[model samples]
Target: MAGTVNRVILVGRLGKDPEIKYTPSGMALATFSLATDESRKDSEGNRQQITEWHNIVLWGKQAEIAGEFLRKGKLIYVEGRLQTRSWDDAQSGEKRYRTEVQGNRFVMLGSRAEQGESPESPRASTAQPTRTSPDQPLEEEEDLPF
Candidate 1:
């Protein structure tokens, strides 16, 4: 291959509300866990459902937006790249590594008038889409046409 691509796309439900924090530079960072389910046939032809969880992180303005709007059990589509980082454990003196998706863009899934949302709620009118760029201009995603 001439080059390698490190892209990841995920459509899943939020396991919990996004967590937001500010870096020393005052840049926003958000982290969340998404859960996806896969079904497979077992040896007896029985269907088995398995759930996989992914850690997702977004930076910059997108982080603030996600932290404010995204909630547990909300469905969303995320496009990003996979990254792994390592750190030394202070207690045990061992190296620890973790892999997570560094999200560039995300779009909320569902109708604007999703269940449990009031008609007058601001989120009810938004398609809930945004993109992150710490070093580049932020890009806004248009409402997805059903």
Candidate 2:
């Protein structure tokens, strides 16, 4: 292929509540951790499971939505690109790098009540809709031939 793609898709549970912050220019930024698990049978036929934690970042409207709706242990589907950032530690003066998924779109996979939220709340009703980047066009069910 002549072009390169930097896309990532992940389905996981949030490890904790998202942290929201604002940039100097007043842009919203949110950060959170997601835990993904893998299960298999060991050589001894014992069930084994491994969990991987990923750092996730959301910006703009996505960040705002995450801050308002996401909570610990909530299942979510995230689509974005991997980004690595480097910064110098203030105390050690050492360069540190961290890789995070910069989420462009996301969907809450389960019902709000399952996450300890009220099902009848307005936010709950509105929040379940899959959110995508503003640049992406929304596709309606009628648009599908099937």
Candidate 3:
């Protein structure tokens, strides 16, 4: 293919509450860890399970929403691209590189009740409406038929 694509999608439970921060320019940034699991029968027929941890990042409005609604152990669906960054470790003075999912959009996977949220509220839907990328226009609820 002439063009290249960098994308990632993950469905997992949050390992902890999102950590929100701001840039010197005041841009919002949210970082969190997600844990995904897989189970299978080993050669000996014993059930085995494996868990993978992913670093997730979100920006702007998406970051704001994550700080407000996401909590440890909550299941979420994230869609975005993979990004790697390197920085010098303060104590060791050694360079360290980390890869993170730069999420442009996400959907909460479980019901409000399952998340310990109020069921009678208008935001009681299992999944939050899809969030657009920073460059894309955000659509109001009235614009959606559902």
- lDDT (0 to 1) per candidate: 0.79, 0.78, 0.79
Candidate 1 C-alpha lDDT tens digits along 1-146: 65667778899999999999999999888999999999999999999999999999988877887887788998888877788989999999999999999887777777656624566534421323334435434446545555
Task: lDDT for model 2, please.
Answer: 0.78
Which pairs of residues collide in model 2? none
Best by TM-score: 1
Candidate 2 TM-score, C-alpha based: 0.78
Number of the top lDDT candidate: 3
Model 3 segments beyond 4 Å from truth?
120-146
| Better candidate number, 2 or 3, judged by TM-score | 3
In model 2, the Cα lDDT at residue 59 comes to 81
Q: Which ten residues in a row have the lowest lDDT in candidate 2?
A: 121-130
Query: Higher lDDT: candidate 1 or 3?
Result: 3
Q: In what order do the candidates fall by lDDT, top score first? A: 3, 1, 2
Candidate 3, lDDT over the whole model: 0.79
